[model samples]
Target: MSTVQRALAVGLGAALLQVLMVIAFAWPAADIAPRDLPLAVAGPQAGAVAGTLAAADPNAFEIITVTDAAAARTAITNREVYGAIVTGDGPPRMLVASGASPAVAQQLTRIGQQLSGVPVARAEDVVPADTDDPRGIAFGVMVLPLVMAGIAAGVLLTVVIPTVGGAVLGLVTFGVVGGLLSMTIVQGWLSVLPGPYPVLAAVAGLVSFAVAGSVAGLAAVFGRVGLGVAALTMLLIGNPLSAATSAPELLPQPWGAIGQLLPPGAAASLLRSVAFFDGAAAAAPLTVLAGWAVAALALFGIAALRGARTEVAAPAEDPLPVG
Candidate 1:
């Protein structure tokens, strides 16, 4: 084969490989929905009522009995329960935590209207998210930053150094920078986000590492162009498809399903729990993120180490009869 033909074939093969890698990560042709969500019930009398309500709508709201209304509200504040139903002698009130999910509040209102034939008053304890921070929506900002950082790491590897060297640098970067970011978050350096300090720190660290590792892995599998594919994976396909700004419940058919497997989707869900809710429901999301990161890192490490091109030494002709 001609030199140009060989080069073209290798390049095309690398490009296709990168695309497949992305598809494997971002595509989830499976189901994605919450089976149970934590819900605190305030009044003892509310047990039957809330239980009945939940039974009627088995898909959402897992009712957990709290001693009193105050306690229930506190649970919501601490991000334990998504919200509560506080029943008093006067009238049963729905305590909605807008921060956890404003869409839930809307759903509750609709349900209330259906049940009572009148609009039941709602007490919003946890308010809706800030309008200013685009990133804060569904913890997308937090996840996006890390994914972008990872793609950047991949680029640095392919462009500035050998694939193996670049991957090593990416791993180190994830470890060092991620740890430092975690410390800052734990120390309460940023006030815009109101979740637990430790949770933020841990999440930031893990996410950073995941992004970096994924990028490195892609670089190892492909080449310089692999960086582009990684960007498409984490940014264009992952971010846009992820229900970060829009709740999965509200999204359209394909995008909603597609979003579930993306790093942003997985990480954002976990982060929301850490930041806005008690860690009770974060296990699944955390596990998903961990799995992806670990898988990417393992594959990258193996390929970068093993699939290396051997250094070719030029043959020297014997000095013709030692002139």
Candidate 2:
């Protein structure tokens, strides 16, 4: 085969591999596990009652029974947990942190409705969401772009041994694109999503940065397989489980349960809080994103340095084995 033909074939193969990797990673994260959400419950037999309730709905909460309403309220303010539930003869009241988890917010609503016989009312001590922000919609906005950037970074870095540098380049590209589309084109053609252009731009940049760093870092570790990690992180696992189109409460138990751990899900919750809600909006999400970025950078840095040292040390031994 001609050199040009071989090059073309190799490029196509790499592209195909990347695409498949993305599909594999980005699919099947429809299930959301509740994991460790802090919750406050109050009732006469709060301990046994909360434990039983938690056992019944493990996917819904990490239950903690508070001493009283005042303690519940205090717990929420201090950011000790995401939501609270109080049981009484007449009805039940749930305290939800609107900014923390849209899924949790939705879950409170559904739980309120399901407690038949008893009346349930949601209390508003926590900060409320914006009239404009749709809790779940935030995921699609920031996550989609981030996932794309990650996929691109993974592919570009796979063929090159110093995948870290290539991955950084990919992140830079995403940031640029996000700035242009979300910021510069505020009034352009992106009216499809609604919201101020500035807000969108800021979100876009953050998402881009996170996705790029994550994808690049993963690729540095796994080589071609890193594409799958990136895809799973942003597209499949993160996006579907994210509180994008629907709140966790809105989804079935599994999706709601696992949603918080995903990046898009976390960011989606944060964006909704920043745009419309007020409670603990920035703290958790900022920490999550910063954590992701830091971890990615660390991994990429270590792997990259090791790879460079290896190449320099080994330096290729004789390649003259032709017929």
Candidate 3:
């Protein structure tokens, strides 16, 4: 290719990358709305409440019927639903779990007002967020740093460490230390996460390992190209679609679901579960992180074995005859 052609190609590629980044980051925020967001209606008026919600926005919520307010609260605490409406002899009450997603809580609060046809309505926060970071801004912001740190760890391991075994060791060491440091800052200093320190540390470690290990393993096998691919996947695809800033149900359907399958999304979900929900509904995210971590380690081992076989197969040079 000519020099001018190459230059134009590079410029066009840069422009395309910028456009894709904008779409990845902004699209979800722009189109934020409930899509099959789980909501509960308790008491004898459950059907009526469901009908009202459906009439308002049929595709917004998936109404779950329960016996009473207590059941509704239980469901919210267990992370089964985002919020609930309870009706009895008196006026209806709105139950919200702001810790799950403050944005969703705000939406439900508006719905509550609409249902009552008043500026204010009877409402309760069954699972309120921490006072220190009520809006969940800090929680959302935490994931990006962790991801970047993981990427850096992977890059350093691949470049600085000469052997696969050393890289694996470095990855593990980074995970443990990184987890401890992260938990200390976010939990101890920031007080954004209220979970038990040990568990939170462990979760943080797993997240680091999952991300770093994936990057390192890929790079070990495929070199610099693999490094770029892994980093971009975690940053562009994983970070934005993670829904850490909002609930997964709030984002576009399949993308939100796909995000949870990636490291960033799984980490956010797992952290939230341990931090506020007492580890409720944690099985899926935990599995996702574990799977990534295990697979990454396996890749590293494969690379090491390949290196060993190549070394053994290589023929040695012949000794020079004495002069």
TM-score per model over all chains: 0.63, 0.58, 0.96
Query: Which regions of candidate 1 fall more than 4 Å away from where they truly are?
Result: 1-91, 106-120, 124-142, 163-166, 182-190, 196-198, 224-226, 253-258, 308-323
Indicate the worst ten consecutive residues by lDDT in candidate 2.
Answer: 185-194
Deviation from native of the Cα of residue 228 in model 2, angstroms = 4.9
Q: What digit string (tens of lDDT, one per residue) describes model 1 on residues 1-323?
A: 99999999999998997787566434532433333556777775777767677677776566788888789777876666666766666555667665566655566556545544457555554545534442344344455666677667656665666566566666767656675675465334544556566667677767666666676677677655665666677876676555554355445455655666767676666766766666646887788778867877776767755654332344556887855
Residue 201 lDDT (model 3): 92
Best by TM-score: 3
List model 3 lDDT by residue over 147-230, tens digit each: 989999999999999999899889989999999999999989988878899899999999999999999999999999999999
Candidate 2 residue 74 C-alpha distance from true site, Å: 3.9
Higher TM-score: candidate 2 or 3? 3
For candidate 1, the per-residue lDDT at 57 reads: 72
- For all predictions, the C-alpha RMSD in Å is 7.2, 7.9, 1.6
Model 1 shows how many backbone clashes? Answer: 2
Write down the lDDT of every candidate, Cα atoms only: 0.63, 0.62, 0.92
